[model samples]
Target: MKFFQIRALAASVLLAGGLAAAHAQPAQPARTAVRGTIDQVSPTSVEVTARNGTKSTIALPADVRVAAVSIAKLTDIKPDSYVGTAAVPQADGTLKALEVHVFAASLRGMGEGFRPWEGADGKKGSMTNGTVGSVVTTSGTTMKVKYKEGEKTVVVPPDVPVVYLEPGDATLMKVGAPALIFAQKGDGGALKALNVIIGKDGTIPPM
Candidate 1:
């Protein structure tokens, strides 16, 4: 199967803290992601069924962004791999890992900074992106990551999910395909596509 990747290639925005409300200024090249199943598709529009069972119809522009998704593994992590993780700060000031995402080498500079991350529980945590210097396996696992300004220790528990992205293109656009559509609203009160991330061969996009 062929692959297509959505590369966030904008300039890095270094915040004072984790991706937080404090750094809530709007970005210039803003990108939006809509994760759902494709229900309908045409040259000008698309209909999607969201994960929660809601459906929405969006305009598909000529220059819509399209990418492909693939599966990855935890053992694929190694030294020099650029990765990011949402971490909860421990009482001892270290970081307890919540979720980890590995990036392809093409994304070396994408979001290459740390900031406060909004947790599922309404509390904000931390998000750090850096190259993995080493992985320590003792009780569970530990990833020592180094960024431009500093370093962080990420504690990878036994059951924490780990995955990576792959390079994908726009050819995978089809009905019944699982996709993450990144789009924005136009002046006419309609959602327009920016990025359409698709999965191949009966595979649902897990990212």
Candidate 2:
């Protein structure tokens, strides 16, 4: 299959309620996001060393999809774009965005909802994945995002890092490169990668 087809399949399968919204049923395999640096790479698998020095060797699928998480401007976020933002709650009840990631069209609505996230400021934050209903640019960039369950109002500051996914190839999987692998643990105690998000030009993916 082609890259776009594979990417669509990946969005439907890998992110099908696997991001902790509802509990997985008995048939769904447990999913995990592995953040680490590439230690080794081979035709079949790649070894990743985590920040704490733990290493994991995960097998790659035949058509492993790779996407480049490149930097974007705050203006890139507009109405109807599917986006995910990590933000901390302000005293006035609005969320302050720490980082914003614009999902590709194929992966839109993949993980649509709000959930708790570990903030960059060491405080408890929130992750909102939804469609932008509206955007206002007065004091700060404010967005009202709507999802299946509910909606959230987020204020994106000027200094927040914004990123978007673009088509990428295996050449980004070189040794010592940072990667975020979405994998499913097999019953045999091994992990198989569903897809990978790699940074472009040293811009690490925040989510």
Candidate 3:
């Protein structure tokens, strides 16, 4: 009787240890989906704009992969195009993204040549014809162009039409005619043709 009782106690202890080990295991994380536009993207974070016009920022894992949509329905996307949702991988290799999809249209040409004439000295001034060094802003009706002098950055307003040229046409425009650009003073100021013709070759370097 003593031997049998000792054996039963040992078996019970073994079963309890097994149950404790199982309970100590971590629970699986739930999958989620998120949708939004690419507001800002960096090596570690991606900013997106949602359908409700709200912005959502997400952190990127070290193993994150970036790819463009190749389907016809997604052809409207351009390089650096805003994307909605992206799958995030779990430690166990499962993928998940919330149901949200982000959307953003390129506003490349919406604002091309508007400038703020008022300077820090409270005097109104104008930016003259010069080489475009870089684009400071590429969204909405405002674009800031940095000139070669680099002394000041000029604010371009939304008067002159911004056109995206094909590679062939871009070359032609650079060689053919001069493009006219209007100058303005203050924010949303009056626009007047500053240069009758600026060489069409005026292109801002890549940012």
Candidate 4:
């Protein structure tokens, strides 16, 4: 009986020791992808700037390919938009890329008119005796569409509704096509057309 008790206590001690060792073991570190944009390039090493603007220098490898993104291809993004930088790594763990794109914007004007402008809600509306005008430009949320009728160029403020058609991109728009346009009365009365529709394609439908 004495020997059996001793053996049991020893087994318990060993089990406890094993449990303690297992609990004390270090956890495996999380794996993350090495991604960043290049900032500068050199023969031996490249410098990459991170999204947070931190710069890292990486060594170059013989088998790595270096490439640059075309300015024309980046059309969707505005000019001078910041792209994240990164350093390329070689097989031997050597850094190569001087700059990389952690984040990049498309070049300006490449995707123009592809994205609809604000206020393009597909609601039906109307305008009464609205004058025509050239769009001088847009400011804030208002667009100044100007047109010349007879001797006077009438400036009309059209409330831009949800864009049924984007600017510079004409898609199947015809005169008398159902469209909603904002209009102002001569007495400065302003209201949104909720039901009356107009032909955007150019030919006015018979009244």
Write the residue-wise lDDT of candidate 4 on 10-122 in tens digits. 00112223554656444323211112344455554445443345554444444332222211112221223322211223465332222112112232222121111111122
RMSD to truth, every model: 6.8, 7.8, 30.8, 33.6
- Candidate 3 per-residue lDDT, tens place, 101-192, comes to 11224322222332333222233333222223333335312112332343223333322222222212122222222222222222333222
Q: Which ten residues in a row have the lowest lDDT in candidate 1?
A: 3-12
Write model 2 residue lDDT over 187-206, tens digit each, in one string.
88699998888877766656
- The numbered model that scores best in TM-score is 2
TM-score of 4: 0.19
Worst 10 residues of 4 by lDDT: 2-11
lDDT of 1 by residue, 1-207 (tens): 433222222223333445655665554443445667888888888899876698888888887756555555566668899987777888877798766667788867656777766642345677888999999887667888899989998888866655565556555777788887767765655688877767766445532
lDDT of 4: 0.24
* Model 4 segments more than 4 A misplaced: 1-40, 71-207
Candidate 2 overall Cα lDDT vs. reference?
Answer: 0.78
Error of 2 at 83 (Å): 0.9
Q: Which stretches of candidate 2 lie over 4 Å from their true place?
A: 1-30, 119-123
Alpha-carbon shift of residue 58 in model 4 (angstroms):
1.0
- CA lDDT scores, all candidates in order: 0.69, 0.78, 0.27, 0.24
The best candidate by lDDT is: 2
